[model samples]
Target: MSLDVDIGHASGRGPRDLNEDFAGAVRAQPGDRRQGLIAAVADGVSGGGLGLEAAQTTVMGLLSDYFATPPGWEPTVALDRLIRAQNAWLADHNRRRRGEGAALTTLTALALQGQTWTLAHVGDTRAWLLRQGEQGPELSLLTQDHALDHPDQRSRLTRAVGLDDGLRVDFAQGEAQVGDTLVLTSDGVHGVLRPTRLAELAAWGTADLAARALVQAALEAGGQDNASALVLRVQGLDPRQLHDEQAWGRTLPVPSPLRVGEALDGLTVTARVADTGVHLLYQVRAADGALGALKTLHPSRASDPQERDMLAHEAWLGRRLTEAEVPGVVRVWPRPAHASAFYLLFDWHQGRTLEQLMAGPGGPPRVADALTAALAWTRTLARLHRLGMVHRDLKPGNLHLGDDGQWRLLDLGVALSGQENAEQRALHAGTPSYMNPEQWEEGGQADAGSDLFALGVTLYQWLTGRLPFGELEPYPRGRHRREPVPASRLRPDVPIWLDRVLAKALAPQARQRFETAEELLLALERGASRPLQPARALPLLQRDPRAALQLALGLSLALNAVLLLWLALWR
Candidate 1:
């Protein structure tokens, strides 16, 4: 497997855009004289004073150490170590030059190991997983934000590279099926682009073309932050039956006692099998055989108190969505009274995930369809907003693709709905890329406007296949500087009306845009004032798979040739 990557940046109205990004695979060994790929991204923080330093710190560390392999090649661990080193380096440099505090910034990185992916990250950077079978996005938000001073200050980040210490990170392992696309980015892309648009960009064409589509969408949306994206399709996976050393996921043998089409309690366990090492995900059939999903916590995690809460929380929230009259959600159990293990039962989404359906070429859906989907998603969010709930972890994984082509939100394990504004003060929750500018800068609150901004970004991705700002730009390590170009510049095909809608949603001044999903819906219904501009179909932005394969082979052989040449000379 190969890693796909992209980066985009803009000098908005502020001092400058500080977003940074990296993609592709990187691995190094002392003995193996081979080259794969080295990718990195750095976003300088605005307002903090030294944005550029932060960006350089991250990229330089990756470039210097990317190929050097130690005992641990786990992508997440590798990335964390690199970021930590970068911060330490930055601190020393800052003290020598200007003295006092160090610069601030964020970094994101990913490497491909054969068919598997290794990842590392710091700050509000993000990694998305789009898979087959599952609908919407099979995203695993890979990084935890270190912002927010208090529970009411949901926007404030408490951790980041170049900060004092304690860099918050979220990490995990996952499967990448053929045609599955992984989109990585800094806060820029999601801040400006929408998920639907992201899926369209990744799937509407080749990975490369789709990547550009996303960037263009961000530009049109008035990129206030640096934006970039790396869209790569999974062409292969470790077909070798997964091993503990390879991937750490829940595993189980097919259970024979509870065969498919068997009734167990009010819900029937159908097609029972192991999904990962920690849990068993079963296709559930109602008394009438109407399908649903019952995921019993893996026997292993059954012992972890944290995992237990997550399982129970997910079930409770799934049921609540049902109570709220949401579609794409089903909860047969009011609570998990009989759950032998931490478990959750949800309606089994039959259609492909947004990430899955989004694969393939354009001739893709019309912008109107994208807009419709965006509106529907926002409406659902509004329901939560009314309930004073927040999806602290609103990445693609929790989303499902329904048979109706609608984007169904799922996984309420971390959903914030404890009390009125309780989510606002909660410290450091939410996917980084989806967060608003203010949230990261100040220990601010998560308001409807911030959620609206996230919704806007998701829509932007579906329509344009890009984020508002490219991850290539450095994330801010200093203070807020200038704003970015208009999203129209990136993808002229986007309706001006839609652009306006995005612009309003992505406004840096959250108070300026639509305050609620309903308000945004009204605006979307109006559509762009200008007609769609004609443009040539975009080419895939991610490098061609065959091309990448050839490159990998060529590099490996060249390294071998060099070693042979040196040995002969020595002899």
Candidate 2:
């Protein structure tokens, strides 16, 4: 199927002297495979004298600037950059005016491509969706008003394009299917017509007819401000993008091994970094002399489909996490169409891994630095977990301390998403020392709890320079019979509260451990004032039934003797 859509927009002055509502859309031709369709609406602040100018420039700028962005950038990333620039420009103009009317507007924009639709919104211009369902045509509100919730103060906007130096645009993405109709409206139209009325009118005819009808209806309903409507009726959907790593891997050819100074697809290998058994990593330079890390299957594994698929999965996940705006993770670049081989390009990070940092000339990191890094790293994990992913391996070597003073998580080669198959979940994939007890059991699967347990071990090592469970080896499992030595016991300066937090995180039983990264992060963030207690041991009955039964009989006989003595004394 081909990407196709019918788009229309209408604007009217209504009862206002001048129209301050502007809307526009751009549909890329068939040759523009990735650009898809971009649509936006902006409604200028009513009190501002340059309202019309503000609305017009904002819409025009978005329509033109959006397509100029690099094709590799995700729709959300591109929109964020463009809108922030627009906000800065508008804010500067307002600042220079020196008491003249401010140039501020509400913006709502959409980008649809390859069966996915992304929305970027600020202020009160609303987005609505109409979809045909088994029952009937269903309408849904796709945006929340950035205004006060109070009825009397509803007109006051809490956020707008040029309201301040800082801009916070709301972003959302979802599947866009054929027969879906997206509707955009300014306050003038929505405030006058209820959602029910709007949806009913939007469902009547072609995009053009529906758009004009909505604007006219708003005007007829005594709308006091300019009314505007933009509609996009999906005529067809493009083939779904291949998100499966295995499928993507089979479509590309792996490149032959390269020596330093060799170039492939505009990237020159500057140095061989590491041979990771299954994959090879090299420090490469682009045409512009910017450094990047290139990862591909090793020469021996070039023909191995499983190895290729794993590398592809890593690249896909890295890009996905980076696009999500999660900090402290390495970013993977999109594969260029001209590329002749399958390889992942990552933004080169200049820093040592945590393992190196620990063993460096400076020695172990300072307590304060460790605490700061832990908090930031926990946040990164929380973001990953929220996206339904688990980092199967987490250790000092996989955690990097960049020169930019950021703690980045590395290597998604064995990371598991919620959608992973049973076979994928059963794969034993992590440093033995860092793997939680649950992961060692039969049919054990790594999950959020396991990741947190690994984080706890990493922190414990960072603080005390020793593994909590000692250096565990792969194979037949050996259970830890005693609680791990606390961080405070090994490192005198390690806080008692932190020790307790780590203890809870490292609990052998999954149910006894912190269930989520956010929970552990909160405990760390609160620190001393709200210290967490160490995980309590399981009850004797649960731990050992025979021991509990013997203890119960001993207590019963002692209680009987005491009762006989007391009765004799009373008599």
Candidate 3:
């Protein structure tokens, strides 16, 4: 599929003696559909002697190297690797000229792959998304400010390329619609313009006019530094490109079961690890004797388009996720021209599942271990949420504690991406015990909030060795509501703050839960000192009529006794 875009950029020295801001956009060769488009903006640290050079080199290097990356590499991975190399080069160049200040700059890059947008950010420069809303076009900030929070030091960036020997960059990707507009700006521009005003400027005339107007707006608002703006208006996206792979997957027929000694596609099946009715998993050895996991749909689901599509979607997401804690796909075997079933191979992780580890000889994890796991999973979930995907089935069983002491989230069979259709939402996927209340209702869709609720349940179980809401009934029938008991009640070692956090996460109403995984993670890190407010609950009278009636009768009797005493005293 083709993605047509209208691009524009403008930069001005403003009040600065020399402009240190740079921006550029590059389109892939006309025949190279896979490389897609790249746009970047960089702002040099003004005090650095080589500020201008740093900004120019960063933007130019990124635009050039990103397109030169191998076609097979994902946009985020490619961009990150290129940026790191550029950072090292800049650092080396600065070291040679130690007499002068080191070259340092903030970089933000966006890559449009089909209808997906991948972002790499490492400084105060900002990226924003403007989408058509019911009221009007809405503006949403897409990058963190990456600067010190104190008022006097707010302009000082905490992270930037060439500033340090090693760099930690923020990477995110999400689906983009045809009408969406991606905007990138140096702090000189955004620092002076409010988000509302930026939205207005973004909508003016064409992309070129919009970019020029934004820079002018900044200059008019007392710009004190170099100002720059880059605007990309998504003119069109081909829907078929997004789903063609899935359509091909639906045509593959399920293969028959394999025996331990049988070989399929150069891999010898060694053992069957799991048979979950819907799918089958096998431990296999490649011809070279390397170990791997083979996953394929069950014969029963061979003709089912929905099942096939889910499998394809899972494979697609697995390939895109770059987090170490996310299980990586080793290779996806093509459906041979003659073969019926399709299978996916994954790097075999030789570690116990989190479920097994917790239930193993060690018993429930210590508070420290539980907290660590919670934080790790929270970060992983946050990444997934930012990518506009929800891991509907998040539980101990789907998590693997690698022998290397790393925990990786596994399985995406029921995961939902931003592009899912209504039919997929009504499919009733996910474990009921870990699902939020909304997931039980007809046509209820799971979002980041639902994922947080599942995380709370998972953490509760990990800490207390008990389910917060007890056993769950099957879907369409599991509508019962019950208050979650405090984890401290079962495990005295569980802290009150931790329990409160879980309680809020398990709140029956979606609105009562943490808005995002990042918030939940922050709360966990802060510990009991910052206690979460207890979730609102129904009054005792509404909760239990019998207890309310008993209390009312007791109060009435006491009132009658008091009246009689008063009357006798008066006589």
Candidate 4:
């Protein structure tokens, strides 16, 4: 579908001597719909050596260089690469000058292609989405502020372009609906103006007027630094082309059940594998005698739009992930002209689920085996995170341990993209016992960090055969302070370093946890060189009840002997 955008931007130096804020929008080439539109806003750090130049370069360079990117690259990937390159140049320039302070700036960019809007953000700059709701207007904050959340440290930024050699830019993608309005602003404007006030101003008149009014409101509210705002209005989209632009989850349909020994669409069902009430899995043989697993929704849920969408998107993601580390889908079986069902074909792996393997007569894997599995899963997750995907449901039940000594990640049904919308975020995608604290919150968003938390929980279970946090009756949200008993305390075989790694991964706060899978893997590889003190004293009774009982008996006998000797001496 074609995108029609109306854009406006305004920037003011406010009380500062020089305006360190820069904002701009680039329109797509005439009739070249693929190029789409680019709009960005950047704010230079106040004390930087080249604050003004940094701001200008970030905005102008992004708008110009984004279009120069390779034509076939996805907007999210293209923008991220461009931003990193620009950041490197800025950092290099500062290093050459060997200045007292480096050039630094906050950037938030939006690229609208077809009916999708992709965002790339760093620093404290913000992006917001405003749309008409049934009752009134609805506003969704699209970007999380990179500044400290604590009140006393709110003014300081934790991340920014050119502040370091490597940049970690946040990227998200969502569908853009007609009549939707997107607003991007620097901290100076957003910090002073409330979201409700900004929403009111944005809905008042034309985009330019709205943008200018937002900036003015910030100024009136005691704007203490450079303030800037960029507004974009989606005017229209082609109706016929809308289907092609639908969200990944919304594009697939559910199919009817398959019968064993039945040949349909060139694949013959050999046997049933699993039949959860909601979904069905079957072992199938292709015409050429190749084995595959076919997965689809249960017939009962065929009419359920949400279930069907999730199943369809699972297949979509399975196909999109081409990395060797990730289990690849063999092919999506085409809907037969006579049949009215959709199904996905995945390479048949002869293996048992991690849960099954752990539950075998052999019990949980040894410490070394557990560590190897953890490392393998971490690397797999790193690849997934790099692809902007989060395996929301990461548990032993969803992992396959092949007889060939390899791990395969299973079940993308509940996984989500980093840029998923609010509705998708609300879906129940994770196991309660393994879920991170944030995943339990209302409207909690899952990201790479959440996945890492799940990994920690899984690894802990593998090592100690129990969950870190005791299973809760009713899933808990908000703050939970209960710390898991250290792994070493439960299983003496577990190394202190491994226990420490699990503790960090399962930290109650998302920020306190390992930031990336790679980071966690590195820690695991470097085992604790020295012994780690236990988090709490495990009473001798708990450590070895037999030894404790033996010692208790000996002490009682000795006390009785001493009492007899004293009695005899007194007589």
The sequence of per-residue lDDT tens digits that candidate 3 reaches over residues 197-296 is: 9999998889999999999999999989889999999998744232433544654556798889888877889999999888999999887888888888
List the candidates' TM-scores in order: 0.42, 0.56, 0.52, 0.51
Residue 465 Cα positional deviation in candidate 3, in Å, after optimal superposition: 1.8
TM-score, model 3 to reference: 0.52
Off by over 4 Å in 4: 1-253, 323-340, 419-421, 477-479, 529-571
Question: In order, what lDDT does every prediction score?
Answer: 0.57, 0.84, 0.81, 0.77
Which of 1 and 2 is the better model by TM-score?
2
List CA RMSD, all candidates.
29.0, 19.9, 21.8, 18.6
Error of 2 at 388 (Å): 0.7
Candidate with top lDDT is 2
Which whole-number lDDT from 0 to 100 does residue 346 have in model 3?
Answer: 73
> Of models 2 and 3, which has the larger TM-score?
2
lDDT of 1 by residue, 1-571 (tens): 3333332222222224333343333334445422334455555664544766677657777767866745324455566677777777766666676645557766666655434455566666677766654465554455555556476874355556666644555555544456677777666677677766666665656666766777667767886666666666665443222111133222122122456767656677768745667567788777776777777666566556445544544554555566668654444454233323234566676765455545546534576677677766777777877766677555444555677666777655556555212322355656666667666765665666667777766666556666564342223331211233455666677766676667777665556568777787777666655432332222222223445677889999999999999999999
Candidate 2, residues 1-571: lDDT per residue as tens digits? 7778999889999877778888999877556535588999999985645877788898899888887776645577789999999999999998998888788899999988766788899999999989998888899888999999999998789999888999999987766878999999999999999988998999878899999999999999998988999999999986544233344465567778889999999999999999877888999999898899999888788788657756766776787787787898988776665567778899998989989988888866688888899998899999999998999899999999889978899998899875443445567999998888777767777888888999999988988889898998885354443469888888889888988888888875677788889899999889999998656788877644666888999999999999999999999
Question: How many clashing residue pairs appear in each of the predictions shown?
Answer: 125, 0, 1, 1
The order of the candidates by TM-score, greatest first, is 2, 3, 4, 1
